[model samples]
Target: MTDTGQAEQAGGLSVVTTATDGIRVLTLAGEIDHHTGDQLRHALEVTGTARPRIVIDMLRVTFMDSSGINILVNAHQTVTEADGWLRLAAPTDSVLRVLQLVGIDDVIQCRPTLREALAL
Candidate 1:
């Protein structure tokens, strides 16, 4: 089994993975901002090397700002360029609104759940 890279931190945030079939489900919790964006990017970079479809579970993300959105855009671009996929799962209403206002919703795929993302 390929070791899936998962990030878990005490205070800042955490990302947990649950894989079934070939899809990788990454669940995020806590804040996503300038302070934690780089760390999140690094974790994704590592996982990206494996070329797995990425479903980012954001149901627990309590806060997210432009920096977080930038990180998501970067990841989406990177994965697409690599012929992989990146999808957002269960974004908070606030995050969803921000994404809509910023027009990122048109570019990145956002779904209600990881399973839904993978099916698409």
Candidate 2:
């Protein structure tokens, strides 16, 4: 596993990136609102990889708004178009509720643990 270090921080959000095998794991902490949406989007952007497999660990995310939802939806679409997949891991109750309410959980896979998200 290789740590990509801290990828971005804006407002109350912090994103740390790491890679194992070919999958990129983004561990996020703090709130994800309009102010932090760009940071999250940037962290999700695929660079060299053709089919970027990504897992977003949201265990520490305390809050999220429509902006965050939009970012996630856009990122999911982008990756899916590239034949990649994006998964959400261990989101808190509040975040999971939001995802479920918005039907994001239906669109993007949400795993109960990081290990599950990382699994094929």
Candidate 3:
């Protein structure tokens, strides 16, 4: 898991990375707001630069605001420009609602599970 130093502190959002067969999965937890969104973006941008298949497992994320959504949208464009794709996996109901409300859920694929995201 690639530990972005910021998430290491207490109660900070954590971005853990694991890759298999060139598919990188970033497991995110805790709040991803204005403060932590940069950490998430950095991790995704770094991984997105190398791998085409990127799955973001948000099953454990407690809260995500507009900043977090913006990061994902930017990441989506980054991956797609490389002929790759980004999938958001297993978001909580609250997060899912926000995504749907903004129509991002339609633009960016949101899988029911990490396994499902990886499978595609």
Candidate 4:
């Protein structure tokens, strides 16, 4: 199990969860750069421990560097390996572009909204 700690990191991003219809929805706000990526990773791991399905709400996010994308990919793999699924919701264009660039758009599930992701 990974250490689950929510500490403020770079780009001023903060991660928090809201549950709806058996899905863990993690809302990420601010920029998710290299330093802040760790917080994202921890949030995913923490959520994955309690739920079988994970939804990450990225609408409030303003930017995401490659490191941020990497954390998402790693979290996806972690959830799948745990016999669960991870979905991304409402990613900003900049973050979406990074995910696409890393070919994550093809591997991970993404939805237009958090409600859609929770429904899935």
Candidate 5:
């Protein structure tokens, strides 16, 4: 277990934030698409400021569109530029499929669990 942040729910998704050992984790739920991509991007932007070692727990993310992928890819670039990294944790089967299709799984680190992502 790690230090956890307060949880908040939004229109298309919910974010449960946590951080420990210099890593920040965002547990996400619901759909991620064009309509909600900006919001998610904004939340992730804050992580980029403090430390871009971000782990996005996507266990509850039922769906993701290209917009979601765009935001995540951009975040990865930012994190990498800052000497940090981004990880995607426990994405749903469908979401993982999309990521694989786009070769994003190769570009970004994907972990089986939040704990695993944090450990990395």
Candidate 6:
């Protein structure tokens, strides 16, 4: 239960970042569109960690667009290249449908709950 204090709010998105047992968890709320994609990207960026394990708690996310999808794909690739992984957790029904439609669910693991996503 460590808070990185890296919470950020931009556009209609709010991100609260915390670290649990070395895993970075980003709890996101609001809409994810072109205007807020940069904020999401910043939050996903790994600073000093060689292998970054990230779990995005998306339960509160209200909406998402292509920009969010692209950012997520890029982040997934970046982390995978470093032998790490990114997981999406508890996305709302609408957001989950979007991810599924874009085939993101097949690429990145999406769990039904944050606790499940964080479980190793």
Maximum-TM-score candidate: 6
Q: How accurate is candidate 4 locally (lDDT)?
A: 0.78
Is candidate 3 or 6 superior in lDDT?
Answer: 6
Q: TM-scores of the models, in the given order?
A: 0.84, 0.96, 0.87, 0.84, 0.89, 0.98
Give all candidate RMSDs, comma-separated: 2.6, 0.9, 3.0, 4.5, 2.0, 0.7
Q: Write the per-residue lDDT of candidate 5 for residues 72-117, one digit (tens) a residue.
A: 9998999888888899999989999999999999999998888888
Best by lDDT: 6
Q: lDDT: which is higher, 1 or 3?
A: 3
Give the range where candidate 4 is weakest over 10 consecutive residues by summed lDDT: 1-10
lDDT by residue (1-120, candidate 2, tens digit) is 899776777789989999978899999999999888888988888877898899999999999999999999999999999999999999999999999999999999999999999999
Q: Residue by residue across 2-102, what tens digits does model 3's lDDT show?
A: 44343342347888778856777888889899988778877887442544878999999888899988999998998988888899999999999989989
Clashing pairs in 1: none
How accurate locally is residue 40 in candidate 4, as Cα lDDT from 0 to 100? 80
Candidate 1 lDDT over 5-56, as tens digits, reads 6556745878777665676677789888888787677667734266657788
Candidate 1: what lDDT?
Answer: 0.78
lDDT of 6 at 56: 98
TM-score of 3: 0.87
| lDDT (0 to 1) per candidate | 0.78, 0.93, 0.83, 0.78, 0.86, 0.96
User: Which candidate model has the greater TM-score, 3 or 6?
Assistant: 6
- Backbone clash count, each prediction separately: 0, 0, 0, 0, 0, 0
Off by over 4 Å in 6: none
